[model samples]
Target chain A: MPKLDTAVVGLDIGGTSTRATVLTLTGQRLGSGRAGGGNPTSHGAERAAVELLTALREALSDFDPARVVAGTIGLAGAGRLLADPAGRAAFDQAWQDAGLRCPYAVHGDALVAYASGTAAPDGTVLIAGTGAITAQVRDLRLDRIADGHGWLLGDAGSGFWLGREAVRRLLADLDAGRTPGTLATAVLTELLGSAEIASRPRATVDATIQAVTRRAPVELARLAPLVVDAATHGEPVATALITEAAAHLAESVGRIRAAGAVTPVVLGGGLLTADTPLAAAVRVEIARQWPDAPLRTAGDGAAAAAWLAARDLPEVTDPAALHARLFPAP
Target chain B: MPKLDTAVVGLDIGGTSTRATVLTLTGQRLGSGRAGGGNPTSHGAERAAVELLTALREALSDFDPARVVAGTIGLAGAGRLLADPAGRAAFDQAWQDAGLRCPYAVHGDALVAYASGTAAPDGTVLIAGTGAITAQVRDLRLDRIADGHGWLLGDAGSGFWLGREAVRRLLADLDAGRTPGTLATAVLTELLGSAEIASRPRATVDATIQAVTRRAPVELARLAPLVVDAATHGEPVATALITEAAAHLAESVGRIRAAGAVTPVVLGGGLLTADTPLAAAVRVEIARQWPDAPLRTAGDGAAAAAWLAARDLPEVTDPAALHARLFPAP
Candidate 1:
């Protein structure tokens, strides 16, 4: 087994899922894998760490572990760094890259999104995925990002927000004398699998109200894709939700712009970069907000950033030489 | 004790607090008390009923059960009815409320707010107290109300929304190169005591997370007063949130109007009718949306409804007599 020298691992931890990648000296991916469940920050960092380690082991089943040198993780949560001097320091390692025994770097997953999404170490990046966020980078200082507060409080332009809004509109339909069997209701039935959980159930008579309540949001968020699909079919509520999300994303960009960022914005995340009406709505809104600004895909941005980060290794002396090997610059 | 023929008892149950009021048919208050902890809806109706009955007995301290001829309850998480119907229907005469053997009438606490705040029954009412809701009463159907989907998914234009939005904005400010010691931060500190709950010696991470998470909307709701206060002091964020809430409320009214309901509107609840900028904002927005629509307070409306409900009660011999007794014709 070749002794790994100067390899850096990057891990991205999101609320719905976690992903880890092992990058070789030349920025080539040695291994990668994904795991299910929620953010470990809410679930305890140690438990999350073990889950992540298990995931990494599974991802790198074919790779020799002795070849890896350093690891860093980007996670979503209250992103106050645990190692920082002022932090209460509840979370030391990223939930996706947990149980690190070596010198490891950890930052908010938004930072990783920013780093990998923008393809530049210093630039403004907006992540609009299952959740949405905007971050600014200048002189290695991250500043002025918007809308990454998570599902409970804030997360404007997120899939979760968009999905939930669709549910609200559906309820409004019931109130507005519209038929109950609209797109939203159908979406809900498919998600919750019972009318008892969807509509205003007689909660007082039910002993299983908690069981009903627990499934509510999941029922609601599941309606998001239906909303997107409905918008494609010209449903007003679906269109409104997507449009509202786009407007929010635009407002976030405006906030980043207000914070004195000059770099071209990188838009990354599942909801935004997907080939859907939401992505189209976002692009249109962004164009209206800033006509000339470039909006890049998160995948390209992440892969580019990963390739770029790998160039920092002493083994990869020339960036262009390595970039060609990993990805051909368009 | 003499066997009493007619009397009134009131039960108020909140998510974290409970109160009971005893009264006579003449509306004379008899005894009132409060209890700690959340609603039984979260716990399971049977368990909650036991707790409520136990608490009521502890608070009542009375020997006579025959004096209670009728009982009315106001509870949170009860949906449209305040009684634990599932428990009662399941256990028959096992519950203490059944032991009293009184005819019972149950309604949402929102109805209590309406009774306490409105002047008529036939109107639309907006209540923004600990939780916020806008209810429209068109004839006999109490249809088309908004807000109160719990603290997580929805509750726009409510105090909870305001508080949560404020926190998110403060966090955004931190990410934007600003510190976290804003007036919002001060309010949070005053509310939660400190930001280092995760580091507390006896803290469990999920519990702490849930505490903070659950408190976000409540905290946002707390921002309602702060926004009103800040408007008095002339702060931008405070003013904006209130104004935004007003707009959202106006949009709601517009939707109501679009649904072809030309009814009188009522504004009640702690947040809306409070001595704050919200009253002015709401009035302005509503007037802008529905220029000629009648708007009034909900206290009379609730009293009128309660009066009406009382008149139709099987115990009432003459409807006119009850109406004239509860409400004199102007």
Candidate 2:
């Protein structure tokens, strides 16, 4: 089921989750593993390193780790990890603990995200998952970036922003003593734990506030999917949030493109994946804003990391064909 | 010496800090005390109660606690405290711990902030301190509110919003590999602890992120002052943030006013305090949006609580004179 020593490891460490894969030098998938959030920016380096190494160890269990010739790990806020002595030390120790025998490359998520979407070295890439940010890829490297300010200060079109706006609209309606609209109803159902709590508006409102304040603020991103569901059910407030999210994403792209040429723009991250309502709205808005620019949806970021790692292997002379083989239709 | 029996204890519990004052029925300030944040929504009811009681007890120490005729405390998100059993227990215990002898009342900050300004029984009160919210006060009670949505979902023009925007602007500049603008420079200095770190852009960026990530998200509000300084120095990005803050505040006011008759609108909270850039912009925008609405700046929220407490005392008549004496010309 799996092969070793003829592959490379590709890993994606995100704010909310971590994923890893082993791929043959010719881009054949060998094995894969998934784990909880391992972003050192939020989880601290020790925990992040442990989670990351665990994911890698699990993926390699079916194969010999010694056979892996190269590896690449893509993560956001990696600069913070590299800057901290303990953070860097923990990462080094994690590799040692995992018993990896390979040349490892650690790159920021921005780099891998760009590669995940397009073969071009120059273009724009936008990600709108738990957080949102846009970067210009020039000569296969991340250049100027827009937003990505994290949960507190920015991330305008992020899942966190969408989810927060949904709760806000719900609370505003409850405060007005208005009958629950579909969006508010759905949001409350999810946030307060049941539709039965609807009759007790004050208690519901109070409980919602207490519950939200009790958890990490970033966890609000988990609520973004509810907004999408409401919008699909024709909730005006949810529709408006999607519209605003698209506008914010478009503006971020505009800011990035203002300083450089428009090669092609790639959209990435969970919030803007596939045919989701948010993604559809973003596509429409992006067209209106930049009709001449080419737009594409990114493949799996973790897969992209593996492809990037495998492309440089001696046997992988035709990286594009290898990528096609690894990522078959559908 | 301050008068006894005639005195009242009034407390203002904020997300960032707490303050308390003892006032005579005549509305003369007797003593005051301050402590760290005591908002149950942010710090949990136990910590909030401890801080609130500590501040109140500190203010009561100068005079016999038995002499207090009335006591009032105003805080945001108080509904959460009153609704949760543990939260309520904490408050009751805190009162016993403080040994306050008077019949005490706890009201939302909206009520006290309204009383802090004009004598109008119906109008509006907008606070934009550590958090932002606007309320329509009818008959001296908060009838309806707009955007008091806590740090997680709202508080758009708050200190937290301002501070977050500052750091975001800094990161944008760093991402562009451009020399720091005044706003970025000021933000980096305040956030990273030194402007000298600017010489090493990567380290500076990494350190700033580490510092921000290491602290609680809401603590971003502490960086608000740096934004003001940059705006004062004519930084365009900082100016834009102030302008946006003003718009958000004004829109919140509009939301509250839309549901009620036009009456006096009083602005409170740290960001909207007299003469701040945001305050001035809000005034300009508010005047343009509602030319006939009366506008005033609220006196200290704690002082308002004391004044409101004094007004309710049987011996206290002529509340206008009492408020005049308590707030003076400041």
Candidate 3:
């Protein structure tokens, strides 16, 4: 019989934050911890490892480290980190330093996301947060991907893409000497501040452009929420932009997804997971594209990672029952 | 009667290079000089002034500065520079330092580009070099503009756009596990050396992606010539990209152009001025869009600036004749 006090560790290393969860073998959440971004590609390997350890140690504080039976980490940019020996070593050292004695596996974020939604072994995972990418998972492993090409090259239908389109619409309106719609006005106000826009009506467009171009291009993702808000208020420009973004995301999945495959399709990232207009639009698009495939919204990735760790343990007799317990149907 | 020794000074301030010309009121190209970029928006105002002085001094070496009757400067980012007091002061200081005694007028680069191709005072000018922009000109002044939003926001059919598209095509092929065509292969070879591609067939895609993402985004413009080369060799991908670019350029002009206007349409910048496949495609698209409008390729902007300066002078009676003499119909 499995020890009643036995626990498993799961981590979700994202670009913005690292989340860790400690769960018992029977799917009871024991402790949870969060820290700053721990993705090696965004932060250096050393810093990422340090962050991972911080979150891990915090999560393990309530439960004794010795009682941890298994561990799994779902890391963004996993391929790049695995390819670098120094990065791999840093992560390995981090895992060991966290007092993790049991066997642990590191999987791509896509696979973890797929597992977070369902226990399916084969499926497609589409993510559209700061960047956009779709991956096909086979046997709980990432098989192929499309359009995660970063901001400069691709990332179409992503937050950054949506924000960029909003700015573009404002520019088009300025070029045509037309008054901007609610979305464009909101974007301008957000970027240039209301005072500047009001004080220099003629210079608002130029000021907005300079303000946007002066920052890191990825920061455009911050404007995405404004678009959603505007779309919710029945703003035509925002509505059209959301529809176009949905089409781009659907096309990205279409490029990698095998036609007529009816496996589960998991949607990840804040844009899709949240109950936003963009999420609704994407669901409609996905359903239209794959009417037969069941769509699932990902739950807490760290919890899913812990579940993945618990599923294969010999002590856990019914993995599906535990998954249901961890992530009850909404 | 106009003094035979009277000359006009013209300056073309570009982002990469600045050119200055000295021309007799009779349209004689007396002397010309070139220096580094003098665009105040790219380089700081102080540095831009220095570059302008350098080119002005060189051009004035063969002519007496006091005998220069009028001067015209066509500057990129003219709006931004004019809006800055420091920039205006710097350019004024540079003019004084260069020993130019004649009163000078500053104009936008779009006006100079339109003047370069023809003597017409009203029409449109489309430029596609490092960036893409289209402007309508009325009475030799920039009237309305479209799509000069730089690399991040717009510049849809620009060199940067072309290079980014090339990289995207290569990435797509890599994602699909398919062999890249000539254009994508050439882009990979250029970004990651030929040896790397030959040695690590499996790693080429990742390596190429890393190599690209590590650099400044604007550097992607450097790869545009390869697209032109590939298209010239009958590569389908390159051909398609070129066609798309042409459509975008045409669309930009169409946005600002009046319907059924028989005004002259001028094409400027390296991409359109050179007798390349992209240029030919643009010409075809332009012809198809506005068959009644005369299509003219731009000549040396410095000379066009000199012609503009000389045209309104008391000494020059035949401005059209001087324009023809300076541009020399091809």
Candidate 4:
């Protein structure tokens, strides 16, 4: 079962961090490394490339780079970055500097996330973290998508959407002279930095509104976890918000999914990957929509990337077994 | 009922422009002037005061300022401006420089909008222009308000809300590979500067999204009129948007309105004051909720301010009759 001195490398470039892992063809861990954000869309191409190189070098420190049979990279904003000449050049330079002789494949982050959940080549992936989007994946590539329009226009069932609804509900209660519910009170305390402000309804409402609008709109996503916490405690407002979010997310998947087809459904992103009320609610909603579909939560992305690299190698005959070894059921 | 020498001065300070009018006690217009924005919330207190003085001087150019007995100013952000010492000092200095010895009163813009519709001392005023807010007025002063939380948090049923919904629907259609409807096509032409981009669905969707997000988020309000126009031509998507907007606006009113109360209801702002489908839908919704409430559209704000100035004078015995003479029946 052991591979003789043959290894593979994988990288996951995200907006917040870059992760790299080196693994044997049999899924044994060789080395791993982490670095700052390497997404060219947020950080410039040059800096992203440099960070990518830093993570890659660290991961390959204890392994022989020459023995690597294959490599794979999962990148956010892959299309935008690869389409630009400068971005492509920076990435090429990084790969060359790593002294890797093996051929490598690059894929969109969504596809890699789908691979992280299951070995299925055709399925759907729904991500509902800070933003929300659903995509239909065929042969491990994104084929169609819905509702990834970001926080400004869409992202209907996202963390940002939940947070905004919490604040709006608080404002409505204050305006109506009714006491805010537990969830709204928690949101006010979090945003205004104190629960004492709740005594003065009018002034507190005005200050809370100002406090939220003054900052970046996306920062509202920070309150999503609080919503989940309150819902876990049986808060009605938060429970309702979670239900609505689940419905919206299910609708997004329904838009791209085939009717009466029970394909695999992979749930990614922080909201779905975590063991939260929203995750459970989404599972129920998706099951109601497609009862026969197999639901899976995404695992470690770097490990998944490594598995993808090893899957196509001549030595790895059973890709599904390799995938199961890499990401066992929780 | 002509007054020999008494006159009144009124100023309406808004975010876009400032207007001042001099009127005789008998509701006859003596002189009027207009200038740039004088809302201290947008323009600083110093510049707002300067503009106010300029408009006052121009309005009094043909009339004797000494004969003006009372003055009234309806200002946006009245509370914030008056609460700050710097803002108060600026307005005081400007008032002293204007050569008026008469006393004056300051009221929130909502009150002035209510007065523009009816002479009733108490009512509810709903505004749904670039933003949406509903207020209860008691004795011509703001009593309570609902849903003025701005674009980021609330402002449901607003122009910005309608515009955002239109863009979101277009994106949804594009993501689902469905041909966009007339309303979405019009919005695309407006944002992308041409409909030719529609030939390339994927690239055009990406470009259109980038174009809208790259600018100020509030600029989405510019697309509201397009939704209304399309709905006028019997577009289903636009008609649905208008219906939802009307429902939201009516719901906002219902939040603060007293059940079965028949006090006057004044509808202000561009969406309600104008003759449009949204206006008709809103009227129908509001009437269904409160069948006996008299619904009226707001008229010239400056004239309303002038009438407010003359409302409590010794010579003006009948204020309601004067208001009718000033605004008249539309």
Candidate 5:
């Protein structure tokens, strides 16, 4: 099979959604596509792999898929896929279906996010999305990870945790027959309804609980941004939740790092990527521990995946140009 | 509609199990039976009602259903039942099926547990079982509750919380490539078969996590006993978990109590009932806060409900004898 020297593919598979990109080896964008959640760990491996292929197919429609020289896929909970033969078969089947004869490797999302953020291969990546996890990279290999316990057990600084805390405060206020603060009021309004729940706080609390219990527990994460919005408006309870979340995230990084190492700390996930108070507080908290450490937000993971794939190629290419293209100034 | 002066019925509908008991007005136990869970909040109201009736029928098989006079039912999260029309209909259907002629009222389990434990009408009940919750009571009515947020949100100090903490420590130890402690070792053995998981710590950790993720999140409570056993064997991680659990439970009680009030503090639920270190530590913590407050363990809630029903009757009775009959030694 002859390779198309100009073509490469990159993918970022997450719990919520998956994105795929096709670009030239010389950093010219060719195609991009998106599909539903493709985290094999959250969704089944077979479904995730099919979704990944769906996105890749859409992205490679303009080019020959077989011509792509290399490809990389980053996913959370990738261990489950690797641990099962059926799961591995799903990946192979997806690759074959996409008509890709090129070589590709699957990597943990934490590693790819770190690679996307900084050129340094020995730093850390802290992600606080629906779930929270921190990983340490020593010379580009993931050395250790901490606190990605999912919503049921841990994910201390994650969206689910914050939202759950907000509802708990609201319920407590309702039980105590006290007027809810700005944070609780906003949370209840979003959870129950606009007008009917306004007067009956206890009923609102009951309905909120009933709703969450009847649905998926992960759906509670949807309420997290409202909490952030309340905090931005100076709600003390919301502010306290943000402070605690930052502390938890910082603690996760501290648990993996040694004393006085000037490692680059890369932040990823929607909570940190948004220009919000929680994001700013997390940055401040990280700086408190490593006074001189550089902080960076991750570029598009799909682009980083391409860079990862292209890094092993036998040609010299400008990595900085790819970074500039993927993460253009806003 | 004739009431049986000699017979009274009581029922406890819970998330995991439903129990019913028939007793004479003088506290002579006639029959008792247990069936599947009947918590309308966890299971839908229709199923809960059916299960409740099934338990009652089994207990009442030896007696006339119409003879079950002055019945009382204790249900957890009963508000959900009250709010839904179909749920209310299920309750009505069960009542009609049972042929009850006497007055009956459904009360929250927290209130019934308080009545079961102490002679005083105003006090508190701290329950730490599959879940953890504390309620303040005044004159037999529930005043307020704390920390009953279910496994997904709160329930801090619960069996699920302890189990979750154990697995977390196990994962951390596995990630750090450290030797398994007593707690981790026991948890792995229970989650995976002992013979297969004994040697490979990393595989065991992965298997443990994979197994938990596949099941209902609340099933984490099944692992709590292993942690308690490890703590008893002096594993530092397990010991720390139990201590934290005690602190959380005590804090819940503190949230509801008044300063310098000599109110009784009743303890309920399996974790507190068992002669474990958690229960002992909770007693010590409670004593520290309320030096003069009496500490009591609740008798069977079904018996308490029956007693509550019988208390209003014109016939005088020996309360001490009834308590002794319900919670006999061993």
Candidate 6:
């Protein structure tokens, strides 16, 4: 098949920042842009969105609209299409008609990871980042999600969860009047900057405490490896947290398999990219839990979402030629 | 000290039924009565109070008014005492004089379990009835709690959780076109009284479907044993439920122990009574989770609550002494 020139733009929205990229029908990144701020949906549905579109426009300033025929956005915490009409309108309008150029598809970031990573489109993605979400892509639709229930309630096997768990263990060590173990002391010092977390007043301590909940998904995800480091150094508490996180990821993978998904998973995001023991732990757990499942690394999820959007628009290019255009010889 | 002749009453108000017992200073069952109706608090607060008082007065008609000093009533759910002085007055006037009794406390029935089961004045109680709630009694107060987030949300280690889980597993099995496993088939048979739960009409199924959330604590609680039995009989799903339930229970227990509590634990309610393997599994998990903690059994929580109430007010002769006074000997 001849290479397609027309391209689609994909936007990856994270808690702290946003990244945008234009990919050709062959999956090559033509131009990219980045911006900052949490998702507007997390803030007020309306106001946060205005800021996002403004930011998106600024990111796409260099791109020619004629070359960009369609778009897709992989957003954090957006499980599926807005179930409620009002929410859908709000999401659509907030993007300032980013979907106006062509049919815009919005999905949870997990799908982007799967599409980009898995050699075949039918597989799963374990996204253990600043916030954790497991996305299983079966065929072309999003299917069988697990965890990602937010910070106060769930999000069991995530980077934020790991950080919080480390803090909890550290506090316990201090209260028990024992030497803070390697993991506890390291993570606690990282979170509290001292051994005085136990002595500080609740409000004061809480203020000093790191915002483990809202770390920038791509940046704060680096903490997962620190935990892995401590665990590798024989830190029992750190090992347990990482192991447990792996188990949770594995459980979600198992559910996807049980739901009739076959092997081949794409691993993506901050936690998976870290060169640490925890990532190995996750692989071991996944292998043990689903032995037949193969794993692969994923690229920028936004590009995949853009590729998907472009795939549906035959006027833009042949759908099958999207990935090759985006990542050719990259 | 001489045995006192004064008496008090204890009421256990549930969703579908209400039980009131009169105990002589020695914790002897002087008189007992029952009523059918839901908790008044669930109805209009005022209307429920009026009806509740009417029932209380009817029950107390058998007791001499002058002898009743202080009493305690255990209710369902958590909330602060209605803060409005006038509202409290109206509530007291509405429930009749029972609300005016000195130290008359309104608490969740899980407290009844905690008081009834634990040998210590303060300990933890795992209530696995229709709904599940794990309560920690510390400093004579209903201190920390976990689960009981209702059936739709949490309640991980309860019988209701187990039953609902079994149903989900069965449906998943059927959707996969696999013959239902032993555990799934048993649950389907029990829930639908048929070979397939999937075959039932949506509304008919919804109507017949035992929503574990609205279930009587006692009834939903009874499901744990079925799962345990299935596990012992070699059912994978049932065994998994018991194991998962134990893990959840241990997590709750761990949080309590981690929060600087050294109190012993009391396993209470119908779920923990002798003969069920669920109790043993829970105990093993608790032991593994909190190695040094002592665990005990609670027999007849309502009766135990009455006994503890008496123990607190020595002026009311001790329940053991009162039992001797009333019955002459064991």
Top TM-score: which candidate number? 4
DockQ of each: 0.26, 0.34, 0.54, 0.76, 0.30, 0.06
TM-score of candidate 2 relative to the true fold: 0.77
Q: Clashes per prediction?
A: 25, 1, 0, 0, 0, 14
For candidate 5, write residues B20-125 as lDDT tens digits. Answer: 8898866788888788998998799999989988888888888877766678889997666777999888887887786666667788998888888875678999
TM-score of each model, paired residue for residue: 0.70, 0.77, 0.91, 0.96, 0.81, 0.63
Q: lDDT by residue for model 6 over B202-308, one digit each (tens)?
A: 23233234443345433444555567779888687887787888787666566545654557777765656665667888989877766666776654534554555
Error of 1 at B17 (Å): 8.5
Predictions ranked by TM-score, top down?
A: 4, 3, 5, 2, 1, 6
Tell me how far the alpha carbon of residue A35 in candidate 5 is from the true structure, in angstroms, after superposition.
6.4
- Candidate 4: TM-score, chain B only: 0.96
Instruction: Specify the highest-DockQ model's number.
Output: 4
Judged by lDDT, which candidate is best?
4
Root-mean-square deviation of candidate 1 = 7.2
Residue B34 in candidate 5, Cα distance off native in Å:
7.2
Segments in model 4 whose C-alpha atoms lie over 4 Å from true places: A197-200, B197-200
* lDDT of candidate 3 over B1-330, digit per residue (tens): 456678999999998899999998877787898999888877888998898899999999988888898999998888788889998999899998988887888888888989999998899999999899999999888887888888899898899999999998888777666678899888988987772353434366567778888888878989999999999999999999999999989988887897778999999989999998989999998888888999999989999888889889777888889898888878
TM-score of chain A by itself in each prediction: 0.75, 0.86, 0.94, 0.96, 0.91, 0.78
Candidate scoring better on TM-score of 3 and 5: 3
Residue-by-residue lDDT tens digits, candidate 2, B158-180: 99888877887776666556678
* Residue pairs clashing, model 2: A5-A67
Worst ten-residue run, lDDT, model 2 chain B? B197-206
| lDDT, candidate 5, A261-313, per-residue tens | 79889999999977888899999998888988989887788888887787677
Which digits, one per residue and each the tens of the lDDT, describe model 1 over residues A32-82? Answer: 767754355565565555556655766567675545556665666635346
Q: Cα lDDT of all candidates, in order?
A: 0.58, 0.80, 0.87, 0.89, 0.81, 0.61
Estimate the lDDT of model 2.
Answer: 0.80
